[model samples]
Target: MDLLSRGSMVSRHGLVLLLLLLIGCVYADSDDQVFLEINDHKMTTLSNMSNGSGRNEQICTLCEDFASQTLSYLQDHETQTAVISGLHQVCSKLFSLKHQCLTMVDYYVPLFFANVALIQPEEFCQKVNLCEMMASLRLPNRDGPCTICHNLVVEFLTKLKDPDLQLEIIEVLLKACGKVEDHVQECKKLVFHYGPLVMFELEKFLETTDICAAIHVCKASQGAAVAATLLADA
Candidate 1:
């Protein structure tokens, strides 16, 4: 081919290469912008959380109060206390934080409701009052019978062996649950469905007859706050 013709062909290839490079640069710029936007959004969310946005001041104070109350209950009912004690103690410590206090409360508040949602005074009349005065709460903006209440009572009656200890537990649960009204229905359903399973495990634990079974029971129940606690952690 002639030198001029060869030169023209090389120029055409060079123009195509330049266009490809420009397209790649445009994509890279678009990707960088997206990364910046995402990073900025994440930072804004973290900032809002730090500022306690959309959080109630009352709930913040209650978290600390709850931790204190649980510690007190555990201290008072030393003999009957179990894993629920440890969960409160940790939550108590976490509650001391000025930060994320409401979120922690939000986690625990529902479990308390579920813990005592089933007890009925009539049902437990022959037995201990698992359904004590505190247990019979008419949650605000709530109506209808609990879907899980009856089965929960049955489980409490048959599956749980230590009636006295269980009484103290239900009382403690009632106290916490009584204080918080948020997510009452949802938490009750979660516990009502899952509480029997947990109790089944606890019932098996109780049957072990190991001297340290109480300690293990306490460990297992850590989430009653354990149920709420584990579910919250999840």
Candidate 2:
């Protein structure tokens, strides 16, 4: 080819390459900038959601009080001193209050579980009343049924990372459920439902060298069985 023609063709090729590079850079910058904006918007939405969230503080207060009162009733009243005494009236009232208080706890307990470590031990003690009361009442009323009232135990296991607590809770629950023939059916379903999830966590917990951590995996496995038994026996 002639020198002039060759020079013209080279100039055109160089210009095309430069144009393509500029177009590619523009698209890359646009994508990066758009992704940053999306992330920033998500952060802003999350912040607003957090700020606006509030729980039923009134319900929480009542639950705490009723649980405390019921515990005090057990401590002060002791074994039935007399069948005809007005102490029976107080006991009835206290039991009634405990049941009512658990309803409130059911609504607010998830919130408490979210930040469980920050909550005072006394608060946890009060909350334990709700679990114990629900487990004890065996109420016929379907208003707020006892479906996995031990959810707090599972959550505690997840956060506390203690196997002994997991096993203790499992044993206590097994003892509670073993008494009731009616619980067999429900326990069977529960076993299938929560078994795999807790097992997965237990497997993870087993990897740790800490004895305390090791205990959790062992207990979690038991706890899952206890949960299964609840539905199984029903």
Query: Cα RMSDs of all predictions?
Result: 28.9, 31.9
RMSD of 2: 31.9
The reply for model 2, stretches above 4 Å from the true place, is 1-160, 183-196, 199-234
Q: List runs of model 1 lying over 4 Å from the truth.
A: 1-73, 76-179, 209-234
TM-score of predicted model 2?
0.20
Model 1 / residue 44 / CA error / Å: 54
- Per-residue lDDT over 75-155 for candidate 2, one digit per residue giving the tens place of the 0 to 100 score: 332211221132223223334343332332333233322343344434643433333322322323332212233232333
Q: Judged by lDDT, which candidate is best?
A: 2
Model 1 lDDT on a 0 to 1 scale: 0.32
Please provide TM-scores, in order, for all candidate models, with all chains considered together.
Answer: 0.23, 0.20
Write candidate 1's Cα lDDT for 95-198 as tens digits: 23312323434444334333334433232231221222113322222321221222222233342455544444333333233222453343333234334344
Clash number for candidate 1: 5
Model 1 vs. true fold: TM: 0.23
lDDT of each: 0.32, 0.33
